[model samples]
Target: MLNIADTLHGWCRAARPFALATVVGTRGSAPLPVGTSVAVDEDGTAVGSISGGCVEGAVYELCRQVLHDRGAPQRAWFGYSDDDAFAVGLTCGGELDVLVQRVDPGTQPHLAAALDETVQGGPAAVAQVVDGPDELLGRTLCVLGDTDSAHGTLDGGPADRVVAAQAGALLRAGRTARVEVGGDADTCPERLSVLVHVHASRPRMLIFGAVDFAAALSQAGSFLGYRVTVCDARPVFATEARFPYADEVVVDWPHRYLERTEVDARTAVCVLTHDAKFDIPLLRLALGLPVGYVGAMGSRRTHDERLRLLTEAGVTEERLARLRSPIGLDLGARTPEETAISITAEIVAHTNRGTGLPLSHLSGPIHRDRALVS
Candidate 1:
């Protein structure tokens, strides 16, 4: 899916009136998770995808209606059934609750600034009044920067203050949630539901090799919302021109660079440097880190040899067990690009605690819990 905030920022800068459709809730096996959005302009131009091509046409029509009527923020539902699947289709056999609203820079000034922050890869959150009174509908509260400072018209009032505090908490947690404000007999009897969408900085993907496969993996990692860094000891190979998609290029030893760099639970470390001089030391340190993944690329024989070397170096067996020796899933990949896909697929599956099984074979919900480690 395209970056909705970046696209919205571009359209807003061009002064194009548009309607933003966001999936605030879902049930069963919805293709996309909550917070996914698609923006449709008056000219019928659209960007982003909320359902992976499952219900764009119907959502587009809703956008047209919203723009035509200059309506209040409206919530619409689309379900997957044999009867309606052929009409307003969702092949995934799931249901979607979408909120569509007409947006303009003049009306949604805070949203415009939030979009700018998101486009610049800064952390921010946008809280929208999805279900509320007519005056509160479409009202937004945006919290920008790490300090959790609030910016928007949705402040000052008691209920609005509650929504802003909830949004800031969700932003700090780096997770999206629906918060209910008011509904108190003493304060306000009517309840309002605010959908808080957290926009954190992209996760980091540290590729330890600047080889032919690194180029492909860098592109794939960037597409998967990772700020990729291609690191190598050879300055000639670790040039920005080689891996244009990488956010940074570091000409340093793999293990040394990783030791000093900041890595969190969301970070992924892929040690594609197959050489023992590079892989052994790097894997030893990586296996002990708190990062999400640690994988080394090599054949079985090379893996065995590397393991022996690591064991002899006094690395614990439990730490050794953390390494994904063959690197990627067993996809029979031959080309560098295909190998990159296999590696990234494994990383994603590992990050989500998935079994790397095909969707057709899975019996449970296709979408996993969207929350990351706090």
Candidate 2:
């Protein structure tokens, strides 16, 4: 699986035979998401996890069986059980459908190419037939979504084209899901059902400021799984040594850098440079883009002035509403690190549609089902 790309790549290159067990479906409070997986080598060595630990031991044996007997593309089900400690299931009140398949250089000629593309940090996806005809059970397809390039075939069947295109589309949008094709879902037992796992690069977090706050924010953003980039026109302040956590420290005008760089719906922009000259020009462009989050750090008076200027510069009221001025929650943070936490918390809340209210003040499920990411 793409999750353990390095280990898989190493096994593939060394011509090591292995079996891959993937979590393809889940219900209730699953500890891990759908694409979580574990790879077991010929020696019974495992590389990853599906359940936190509850189901790993059972799945480990499944992988070993797949390798020894080659009677695979096996599907196994595990569920929560409090009545029996010896039961091979999750203890976390969740159920999972796991599929284990054998992988080697011979049967899967694409074993190396798929791992290479993913390990190199390109946008790639792997689609495997989880439910379908016997012959199509372990059929897998690998796609480099951005380039419209693919590495494997899901059998030389007509269903191959369908899953390939869908896999590429999912990879481009950075989504993972189970899809059905080739037959009506209500009736046909032979209908092709594929589970796609995408390995897209980390989303970008553009922090436009070179202050100490930016350094702290860069660290916070990186810990939150963002590829942080710190940008400022001031070369001395924007040095990589200053913002150690930023993936890139750019010495360019903030507005100019944003215009030339790539940004998408998953990108987050933080305007920490409160100066009017840099703030106005850069924010005018960022507000119009299809980015995920846009926030600015400033006092109440600065926010009022910035709003008036952006309005005069023709940023509509609707677009202006998208900006989070006087950035972060009302955490009353007094230090740079604390402010970074406040800001990152707001970003997470916004992204996940979470109420800013403390959990103790509300009552319901602690976590909601996430929407299919794009």
Candidate 3:
């Protein structure tokens, strides 16, 4: 799928066929999220991972079978089996369903073009049938950004249009989801049931400072799969050479830039400019937004003063409570790189609803089950 688009695009350009294995469903402690894919060339070259190293060997062989068989797409289930130790399964006591589909560049040119577009940093979503009729297996429908027109088809009927609309919604939210379709004439023409996987664009991370800490945080954000933007009013400080990892470097007032930028529940905003002039107006605007994480960099006294100023400036305590004043977790970080880790860790914990407690003190599933199998 989209996760391995770069590798597949290379094969597509060379007219080499490949078998794509995508993890479409999960249960228990699935290591990889759904939409994670592995693509194998005709000669057994593989790109990407499904269950880390747990079931990759088996999946590689399955890829070869799918390419040669080239029949309907095949779905393989992997999970722990106490019945037989020799059986190929996950050791993490998790279950995953992988859908293997063969793609020929000459036959599926539209799909190849879609991969090309995605690899070139275009905004879109591709809904592929992972659970459905055998005839519809491996079928895909791509919904380009803000476009009513779609690139491919599922049944070349009403079902295709329905799935395209669903994919477009999830695409705007930057989410990968399992979409169900098919019913009576009110929905689909037939009672054929189908499930599709919709992969979306990356979330945005806006760093409202061009300070040394902002430079390091941009790198960490990019590594965590966020499209990072470093912004500042000073053009000299917000140059691309300073924050090479950032997707964008904007020279604009923090508050003004934030007002003009688009944000969502997936967006993260970090304010590293501790100066009151920059902090007050910016934090006032940021705290009221629907962004996932909002953090401000400052000392204890500075945090108190900033909060008082925000409260006087008409920011409610409820909105102020949403801000992570003083930024970062208490990791005793002295350097910018270490501070960046602390800040990003807090962001992940906030997004996942995780307690900032040590793992040794908590006795339960390492990962929340709800976080998986989505």
Which one is best on lDDT?
Answer: 2
Tens-digit per-residue lDDT, 1-374, candidate 2: 67788999899888899999998888777778887899999987899988888888889988998999977589998997777633587777778899898887666767577788788887888888888888888788888747655578875756666777778877766778878777743333357778888888789999999999999999999999999999999987889889889999999999999999999888999999999999999999999999999999999999999999999999999999999989999898989999999999999999879999999998755555555422
What is the C-alpha lDDT profile of model 3 across 124-227, one tens digit per residue? 67777776667887787777766646787888888877887777777776767777778667556544433334445678999988999999999999999999
**TM-scores for all predictions:** 0.76, 0.89, 0.85
Badly placed stretches (over 4 Å) of model 3 are 14-16, 82-87, 189-202, 234-249, 368-374
What local distance difference test score does each model get? Answer: 0.83, 0.86, 0.84
In terms of TM-score, which candidate is strongest? Answer: 2
Worst ten in a row by lDDT for model 1? 365-374
Q: How many backbone overlaps does candidate 2 show?
A: 0
Residues 1-374 of candidate 1: C-alpha lDDT, one tens digit per residue: 12477778888788788998988788888888887888888888888888888788889999989988887878889888577675687888888999998987776677888888888878888988777787777678898887556788553466656666777777665667777777785435667877888887778899999999999999999999899999999998999999999999999999999999988777889988899999888888888898888989999999899999999988999998888879999898999899999999999888768999888987878777655221
Clashes found in each candidate (C-alpha, N, C closer than 3 A): 0, 0, 0
